[model samples]
Target: MYCFMSTIDPGPPPQLIQLILSYLKDGQSTTEFDLRVMPLAQDGSTRRYFRVYSTNKDSFIAVDAHKTGGDPKTLSAPNQNQTFHYLACHLLERGFPVPRILQHSSDFNFYLLCDLGEVTLCSKVLENGHKNKKSTLELYQKALDLLFKLQTEALINFEHSWCYAGSVYDRNLILENELNYFLKAFVKGYLKLTVSPKSESRLQAEFQSLADEALLAPGDFFLYRDFQSKNLMLKDKMLYLIDFQGARSGPFYYDLASLLNDPYTQLLQTQREQLLSYYYKQLCNRYPKSAPDNDTFTFFFHLYSLVRTLQTLGAFAFLTRQGRKHFQSYMAPALENFHHYLARLSSSLKLDTLVELSHRLYEQNLNVKKRSP
Candidate 1:
């Protein structure tokens, strides 16, 4: 069972809550009363969210984003709340569906924002109980359409004011950092598997090739790093972006893999392909100059999908080991997606060599577990 979270009476402690009430009063006179705090979901991140109920009126979301929540110094650069504010302002101005920023306190590391209420894309799909094929495909197409619109109209001239914001998302960084997650935690710590010097050299060579494909990607649009179903909420037939702390100027395919092949809500293979084609058609309608043909987009799609799958494997392992979370449910599905790439690339000498070494490590770990008292 999941751990029980604490409740806040009336609202969060006086100072911040008081400030929120003050801001609400300044904007509009509503019902004339104090705000009440109600705890909401605190995911694996350091941030905690709350629903603020006004006396006999509607409720708004109060984001208490202290650096000390779980990850230390979260308010430092690339903080979730700060990125949300930046994207919210930018997207909303361009007529995209996003939550209205009521007010923000950078010093306190909290924000009083217009609540989106409780209806994420994942919840809506699950609430339907049975996975209706038609509905799922339609929903994904809708999501893809929004993404296409954002990439074309809104993200074209996106400027990076902050220092870290302008930095290119190197593929080497993605592979090197995420590879450490599985190598250090799962293989070394949990499974107690050691890599020989020869194996390490072969693994590095395979990763170098994969990173080349990922890094060669064009930095076209503003990539919302975690643009999965969990971070997407539906409101009035539109998708709203959330949890955009890691937003960066990166490849077009980054957000594409995040949405279509998300472990949280698995879209069928047919649906995934259909949605990709739909996005390609819609996106090409705008930029006819550098539009990719059918075959070219397919190649890029598969390559990005492979990169995303590897990144997710490492991320889920980190969450399970370090965060003490149950992410085994996601492991199999992620591996299934990863296996597609492995099957195609099996003929490659470096890939085959690395897979052989990795399988040996897995076998050794299983044997160690069996022999343990």
Candidate 2:
């Protein structure tokens, strides 16, 4: 359906284009077929994506993840590009559904991948048909099932250095990336709230306390840092995870919270609780020896849900301020998610400052609101 009349914007570099053209040509003349590159809509990250259309092949997904002229010689602190290359390769070998890496040029800073098609779990969720829910719920559960498999099975010969955003989800990452991100971007920047020195100290202590509790979860499973619907590509009636460059070793609850608390789908609290119970049962079934009991697991699940809520809000606010206006729409729903987890944990937990802030955000109806960033 994408028609190119005349304008052909030169995408990527000459060498990268040659690689793609050569691969697609498959021994034929490059001039014998039409080749076009079209930009794809991207999320909050700096990486750019494109779909390369060719007359001969099914098409390829091209990624511009970094600026040219720097190849990562070491795995330590590898950029998103290196992480994608190694992780995608490893996952593919493990029989996961990651897009096939066809070709990559380190000097040109480009990667050509098998196109995974246009369907995302978010599109399936937002459709109008009621039958979509019946089927979508099954798919959502399947996604959870995949999450569990990835968390457990993929660790056979995993290397910690493949993690681009640090090797584990520790107190420092929680404080700086999640908690402090919420404070700086969502509270202070977006909501325009000024924090007093005393309140700031109290908040820091509360964040540290939260980090401690989150670390208490049993089993260092793989945590897909952004496990929401939009990050899942639905193909062949199955869910395939994307945007996993931030994957690292961490607690089980964080990812469950990410999928359940996702604002893009806006799942009801009851549904979230049901799914949480489903995932918990799986945990018990698999790790009967090491699993936390029902009560303990529920407590930690809600705790991680609250942390995930904060991180989501922070990303929403910060990205929206940076001119990604669509994220504004999800702000209200994310605020509701914050309220949802806060209420669930109200009996066993109480962070008064966060509670107050949630109330304020709702009062504003997140006046600057929008979707999952």
User: Top model by lDDT, which number?
Assistant: 2
* Cα lDDT, all candidates: 0.67, 0.78
Task: Name the candidate that leads on TM-score.
Answer: 2
RMSD list, candidates in order: 5.0, 3.0
Candidate 2 has its poorest 10 consecutive residues by lDDT at 1-10
Query: Per-residue error at 74 for model 1, in Å?
Result: 14
lDDT of 1 by residue, 1-373 (tens): 1111345433365555765667757757463765456678665665667777765446778777765332325435544455556667777888877778777674536777777778888877666543587777777787787776665566654556432343456765666655555556555655566788887777777777777766766776767767788788887767787776566677788789878888777766877878888888876887688877776676677777766777787776666666535565676677667666565555542476557744664454443222221
C-alpha RMSD (angstroms) for model 2: 3.0
lDDT of 2 by residue, 1-373 (tens): 2233235544565666667766776767555777778777777876667888977888788877665225677433677777777788788888877888888875436778888788888888778343456676777789899988988877667788887678788888999999899999988888787888887887787788788877777647877789889888988887787888788888878888899888888876666777888888898899789788888888888898889989998998898888888888887788777787788876665577667666776775656543333
Per-residue error (Å), model 2, residue 248: 1.1
TM-score of each: 0.83, 0.91
